[model samples]
Target: MSNQATPWSSAMPEAQFQLMHDILAAPSPIGLEAAMTEGVLRPHFERIAPDGWGVKTFKGHAGIVLDTHPGRDDLFTVMVIGHADKIRMQVRSIGSDGKVWINSDSFLPTTLLGHEVSIFSEAPEAPGEYRRLDGGTVEALGAIHFADPKLRAGEKGVRKEQLYVELQIHGSDKKKQVEALGIRPGDSIIMNRPIRHGFSPDTFYGAYLDNGLGCFVAAEAARLVAEAEGARNIRMLFAAATYEEIGRFGSRVLVGEMRPDAIIGVDVNHDYVAAPGIGEKRMAPVEMGKGFTMSVGAIVSEQLNRRIETVAKDKGIPMQRDVVGADTGTDGMAGVLGNVDCAATSVGMPIRNMHTISESGCTRDVLACTHAVAETLLAMDAEESQTGALHEAFCSQHPRLDQARPMGHQGLPESD
Candidate 1:
């Protein structure tokens, strides 16, 4: 951690970026592995299985589970859900002839090339930078193409359907464009921020930290937990769930597996910024550069919150507090609804630009969450052991213990 942000902080690792780019490139209109890979016919095979991990699939779902704690295998099953799906990359119109005409929809075009449009709609936030696309988020039913009086095709004229949607990454040019960039549709388009490894990058950039950074912290922490002494037989799952952005589909399937008694979800929180309708209440401005923020509410059990707080305090980890009157719309939501009465909660890092590619994050924020979660897992040994003891005690108290004699008694008609 240097005073200056390190390259790692801003730079995406080859593997991370490749995996990210690949997944982001998928035609993941909604949790796309493959329409062909869905239930019924496909001979679905497990993709990634490590030693000591169980592999299973039911319906159109695939999952992995690790059972530690020997016989008390049923003690608690926790799930870590991270979205792996998103909206379909589509184009509504193509720009052309000094000005590319656009179908009145901004949503579709913006999703496609607006970010990569290589053109401008209006004055940019700063000089030389083009403003966000027109219609903001509206979908472009079609586009107006221009046969630049220069180069290859020699200016071919076409209609909306043939021209407009044809250039989109997920619409028409989806396959070709994605292949050109080695990307695909249904693949979640990550905010493509250049990760830097260092310090003092931003004082604020909160909320929408969501699961991306959360997943990273979990991954690093899981690695440490796995190799630590007295290694917490915690059987941690660093699930990088897909499709949360679309509809929380990843969380849906994951919750079915973990059913953890409680969970500490890692996401983002609103920064100390202001905007209409997004007041302090809806988007509490938890200060950035301070540390991690913890969510509190019925959804987040007091005991669990306090326990995490206690861990933070003891470890000197940085943290803040937030009130939740409604669902946080995170993997924690799924965790709360799962089989076990899980205490759902979240830890956040500072993130700016929310859903935009211009999103920024603090290394300190990510590190703080990692420390908090790692410590929480480390601190759970005693709690889990205590829970195991209580369970054993309960099981030993079977009321009809003496009611049924040995099976031999029933088998032999009482010789006496």
Candidate 2:
């Protein structure tokens, strides 16, 4: 292994930024991630992992999965999964008064009060089948348009009916136009927010940074692993999944299908600004720009965690460890729980304002995570993995007699 970091490390910032922009620009709510994945992510993986490496798209019950596994069987596969969907709203009903009622999906409706939104519609042009429309915006409603003085105090919850999506017309005439556009009651609504860069080029803020950064990291890691020659013992699958905001629907499907020996979930970790309750036992800082955060807890594999930590240290990648007392609330945990038992752990990108507009993070931190993931894959030994054997040095010095048993044996015999 080279002592220096690969040139791929420097390329990650630009890659991360570009992917983040594309994903944020697409109107992909939880159940409406098809356009984003099929339009943006699939093409990216095809371009990056070329040479007949076609991107695989799998449709599921409530979501979609884009598979980017380079066909290599030199070793067991490590699946890198990321959720592509963000929390948004769904069209409920179009009122006769020209305003459309929307049901917020998994997020506060007040956060979307004044923001612009795009309602995806499939409207066909002349002599053509229905095509996707340019999308519309949020109507001037909610607390902003409250005519009653008592209701303008912002003390009450924004009811689903209080918020409205504007189709740009009024009354029955507007309803007819919206129907002509092919937008229905079940159509998705996306926040119309643009990604913004901070004072430094490496830092930026935008909506849906929760898992956008994760998709970027997984994409870059897949590209690096596919392009590198020394990773003969490492197989990788990059899964950009959907419907993560509400549940792990896509990830559960991915685990059952891929059944990889190990699954690494790349997603956002709540920074202090986003989740002040998260703290290390030693009071170690887990702030933005610090580095990648690895979840350590019940669902995480001890062997995988140890190997990843060793790889990150050897590669000089900055990383932080955080404890998750129960579930990590990530796709990796979903895989561990739903699929056959295997190695599972999650690496989180520190993000602020998660699930809200203006969620942000540092590109440098993303790069660190991308590098750590690639290095860890390269460091895994297929022999140890397939044999299901831990290193002698890694074994506990004082193995508990009660917990020790022969392979395939459930309990000690009465003779013993």
Highest lDDT against the true fold, candidate: 2
Please, what are the lDDT tens digits per residue for candidate 1 over residues 53-131?
4423335533222222323445544443344333333333333321223332212223333333212222323433322
Candidate 2 lDDT, 47-160, residue by residue in tens: 777453446666453233334334543446678888878787777887766677788776566667666777765444443233444445554353356555544775555565
**CA lDDT for candidate 1:** 0.47
The whole-model lDDT of each prediction reads: 0.47, 0.69
Error in Å for residue 292 of model 2: 1.0
Instruction: TM-score each candidate.
Output: 0.58, 0.80
Residue pairs with colliding backbones in model 2 are 139-166
